[model samples]
Target: MTAKIEIYTWSNCPFCIRAKQLLRKKKVKFTEYGIDGDEMVRAIMAERANGRRSVPQIFINDVHIGGCDDIHNLEDQGQLDKLLFAHSGV
Candidate 1:
């Protein structure tokens, strides 16, 4: 009944690593899609990210939560935990 978290990342991207680190530190399970240099996969991620062709696009319960700084910003504002602990009606 937990929220389903997903992230699109590039293997060597620092932002991606930082984002994943935060998620791991929180001890939450998330699905990570490592796009690397695959443009087709990147295109799919971009579409899900509202045309944002950046690495480390995040989603919580299928809701777009933006990139690394965005997730960190949510955590800073005391909102990330709310999303992480939510029950998805899926």
Candidate 2:
């Protein structure tokens, strides 16, 4: 089974665009929640992200993967693929 991928973003946010770009480049399918000026959605994202109120908050198999830089770091460390392909127990 494929891992479930989710990302919270804001329209026009550069970091959000960058994060989505990376996921697209990898041909990964993800559910994106665009929270442009929407406090409720942003609040939910923050909660899932352990109170991190940042754009481009990501999740793989319901596990918080953090923001744009964090995802890129995982890719740079050669660990992104592992998480991408991991099966979701949920």
Candidate 3:
């Protein structure tokens, strides 16, 4: 089974771009929420992100994975792929 990946972002945010790039490099499929100038959507994303109002909030299989740096850190630690391919029991 594949992991369910999601990312909240603004159209022009550099971090968001970088995060997406990393995911693309990994060849992981993801859902992107581009909340550019959409405060309502941003607020929803913030709520989902534990009150973090930052762009590029990421989630894997409904688990919050934080922003770009956080994902990169996970990659550096050799854990991102594990999470990306983990199978959850339904």
On lDDT, the leading prediction is 3
Error of 1 at 89 (Å): 13
* lDDT (tens digit, per residue) of candidate 1 on 15-82: 99999999999888999998988899999999999999998999998889999999999999998888
Angstrom error at residue 82, model 1: 0.4
TM-score of 1: 0.93
Regarding TM-score, does 2 or 3 come out ahead? 3
**What TM-score fits each model?**
0.93, 0.93, 0.93
Per-residue lDDT for 1-90 in model 3, tens only?
Answer: 669999999889999999999999988799999998899999999999999998899999899999999999999999998898777431
Please give the RMSD of candidate 1 to the true structure: 2.5
- TM-score order, best first, reads 3, 1, 2
Off by over 4 Å in 1: 88-90
> Which residue pairs come into collision in candidate 3?
none
Estimate the overall C-alpha local distance difference test score of candidate 3: 0.93
Where model 2 places Cα greater than 4 Å from the true spot, the runs are 88-90
Against the unseen true structure, what C-alpha lDDT does each candidate score?
0.92, 0.92, 0.93
